[model samples]
Target chain A: MLYIALKMLMADRAKYTGLLLGIAFTAFLVTFAAAYFSGFMTRGFALIAENGAADVWVMDAAVESVEQTINMPDSALDRIRGVEGVRYAVPLALGTVDARFPNGRFQTFQVIGVDDATLAGAPVLKDGGVPTVLRAPDAAIIDDGGTSGKLLTPVLKTDQWPHDGAHLEAAIRELAVGDELLANDQRIKVVGRSETLPRFPPRPLIYTTFANAARILPQERHLLTFVLATAEPGLSPNDLAQRIHARTGLRARASEDFKTDTVRWYLVNSEDVGDMAAMLILAMSVGFGVTGVLLYIFTYENLKQYAVLNAMGATPRVLLSMIFAQTGICALTGTGLGLGACVLVGEITAKAGYPFRMMWFTPLLGTVGVLIVSLTAAAISARPVLKLQPAVVFAGR
Target chain B: MSTDANHEIAVRCQGVTKTYGTGVAQVAALRGIDLDVRQGELLMLVGPSGCGKTTLISIIAAILDKDGGQCKVLGHDLEQMSQNDRVRFRGKSIGFVFQVFNLLPSLTALENVAIPLLLNGVPRGRAEERVRSALDSVGLGERMNAYPAQLSGGQQQRVAIARALVHNPKLIVCDEPTSNLDHKTGQDMMDILRGVAQSPDRALIIVTHDPRILGFADRIAYMDDGRITDIIAGKHRGQLQ
Candidate 1:
């Protein structure tokens, strides 16, 4: 019976091929979009997680976004450092600054600054020398995650931001190492680029000494934005966070919570490239819908032969089982091919400096979606098939 | 069991009525048919259009349900059986040949023949052997792999016959098996059917319109307006003309 089922499916090779291709194309786009969206968000906010050295993070209150630069005084960092089970405290500043390059092209980047001599105490994103950037007063390191190459293109302020709608393509041409950038006329040279540093599209990234960062965006008198505290061994991380929140009037969060906060921040408050993402998602969904419909048409055409089988004393259940089994096999095979396509395309697209990435979890989701949609398409054709009366062949009327 | 098996009737139907739909659209396809096909007899049903020969044959074959009275093929009563049970009974004990040669287009000749046996839960290999022997019996040994479209009309019809007899069913009901063939081919088909339809243990009931088929039947039944109006007297075999 299974052989008969397979034979019936294979008889219409052209139709089955078309169905497989349609399903594969739909699955590829949906999974790829989901993966890129996930990968983009993860790469964008990696710095906050790296810098938070505490068993938990304690912020002032109601801070929805990490890039918003909520402030606390030096008294808070000092207070957390003195709390029991706390090993060390590092004061950090995250601010936006206009970077002027030697080529007179300027761009903007988020400047992350931490007061740590070894740079291990700072989230370096694996910059070449932690000691150099950590100690350099006028020197800062850059992350190459979004940069085209090893050279870090410094983005200086072209004109006053928040008022000037200056586009990036014209402002910055080529960012390379050793290029000098000016922030409020304070000159600094670009150091080596780090590999996994936090960045967004158009390279919203820069690194500088805490004192150097204070020059462009001055810190309020006796104010600290985030305190990075290391936990001593043998101390429960959650317990330490509780003790810190109890001692200092601030919210303490664990590492997972800290990551969640940053993700929540960008998701809710930030001006995301929303239209592009929405359009991509819609395209993916429409592609899947079209594939499903086309597959339904193809499977319906294929079942014309099976009607003859049923009329020959093949059971109706036999017909159904055969069609669904074909759907399952085609769905699984097509999804495998689609996943392969996504991986190959993702690599090429990523190298071409696009935001596409390959994530296995999202592709699994895509496989499930494809299977359901394909089978549903196959199921839609059952009406005409079951209605194929044996008498139809003889009477032809 | 042996004594009864030797003398038992293969097909019997009494006061069977097949009506289609209701109200103004109502039609009695087979008004009321009383028929009995003895074991091993090759019976041919002949009639013109609207004569209900096919409908009567269908009821006797257990393919269509009768609106009134009873039909029994082999041993089981049609009215008392479940739908699936009826189908299974037909697959196991009876076989049918249509004028259209309704073999699945996707299957090879051998596979087409094996379908009945396979439906009976006979494994493929054994089914294939039976199918092959049946095909050989119909002289289609060289064309096992060929599809119905690939075969000539005569060849396809033989494949249909082979399929019908592959299970060695006790009752073989063929509707117009020779109507689609040329005279010689039709005669050849009857010869093969007569060879297999012989024996006191099996019966063949065929519904056909060709006068040339009268020579091949042990008994001939005539239908008109869904009623079995006349049956050629057994003593006047060739003299009925």
Candidate 2:
């Protein structure tokens, strides 16, 4: 039976080849695009999440997401720290700041100011440790991912060229590493250039002390946007969030909630990213539709052979099983080949710095889509087998 | 119903009726026809178009349901059995040959012939072994891998015959088997069918209008307008001469 089914596939190799290509192309594109989008969102929110922080983000009630500014009193941290099951509550400032290199290269960077001596949000900077630069009042750390608002690659040391192009804070990049920046009229030096792991295109973040951010924008700078606190043994994040919300009129989220919120906020508001993801889904859907049609037509064209089998004393069930077997093979092959091609193409594109990423299970989802389309096609063609009049073989008379 | 008939009777049908559609639109394709194939006898069902010859052959093979009748093939009541059982019964007890060869285009000659045996749960190795001997018997040993489109009409019919014989079924039913063949090729096909009737354990039923095959059958059953008219002994035609 396997031989016969495979023979059928081989006999129509040209046609099946077309079908497989369609399935493969869709699987490749959709999986690769979806992975890149998800990866980007994950990387963006990972730093805050890695801190493993306070359950409640004490902010002005109007702030919708983490990135939004909502200054609370400095005393709120002391109060939250004293709550039950709260291991520790520390002040955290989340705001975008401008950083400059001497070469007129400026970029916007997320200014994550932590009261802890170590810079919490710099994310494993490679060139220099965030701990040393962030602890000093006059010295600060800059994210290589943080986009320098300027594009000068000439002046910085041979290795200090800005790799991250996305600028979030406009104030950071124009200042030279050794030069003084008047943040709120107080001079602060960019002592070192540091980069987080996998900093492809830098976000150009400036890691500073909370007091230093206050000097840059006194009105915008206040108590940290949210504090990080770990739970004691047997304490739950939900319960802790409730406690913080009750006392501060602020919303608290589990560690997962912050990550989810960041992704949700980006998806809902970022038109570019949303459009990209939507386009991929659309392409994936087309792949599904194409595969479905190709598979259905192949099944339909092969219907006569099946009917002939029926006339030759094959049971309808046997014929149905054969058809299904053929469909299953087609779906798996197409999806399998598609995933392989996606990885290959994605690797090539990623090496070229094209932002191509393939998730481990995105191809599985692609396969699921292929199967859905395939089964639908199979179901449609299968109807004829049920309705097939075995008497039709003798119809030519 | 047949205590007197020998156990070797390969097909027996009693009072079978088949109709198409319902009410005023219905046409009775067969009207209460009785059929029987004894032991290894080669029977020809001869009738004009629409005479229910094909329908009768199909019902006997369990390919079509008899509207009213008890049809037995190899001692199993086809009408009484469930659809699945009938399928197993057909795969096990019967082989079918049709006009136009009806070979699955996607499969080679060897693969097509081995299908029934495969569906019967015969392992691929065993099926290929049987198919090899069957095709060799039909003189198609050199063309086993040739697809249906590559074979001539007579050769295709020969492959169909091999497919039927590969499983060593108790009964073989050929629906207008020679209608698509030329005079000489039809004679060649009848000769091929004759070689496979090697034992009394198997029987062949040929539904054909070709008078050239008249000499190959032990008896020829005649029908018109969906009713059997007569059965002539084709074997003793020389005696008539």
Best candidate, lDDT-wise?
Answer: 2
Given candidate 2, what's the lDDT at residue B128?
Answer: 87
Candidate 1 lDDT over residue span A270-311, tens digit each: 668475578777978796787778767765665545644554
Candidate 2 is graded, for docking, as: acceptable
Can you write out model 2's per-residue Cα lDDT over A277-367, one digit (the tens) per residue? 7887787777777877787888778777777777666777777777788888888887788888878877887776555556667666777
What fnat does each of the candidate structures reach? 0.21, 0.56
Candidate 2 reference-contact recovery: 0.56
lDDT against the true structure, per candidate, is 0.71, 0.72
| Docking model 1 quality class | acceptable
Report the C-alpha lDDT of model 1 over B1-241, residue by residue, as the tens digit: 0111234677777778888779999988887687777786777788888778777776776656678977777877888987566656767777778888877777899887888888778999888888888888889999999988899989999999888888778888887888889999999888888776556688888888888878888678888888887776333233222
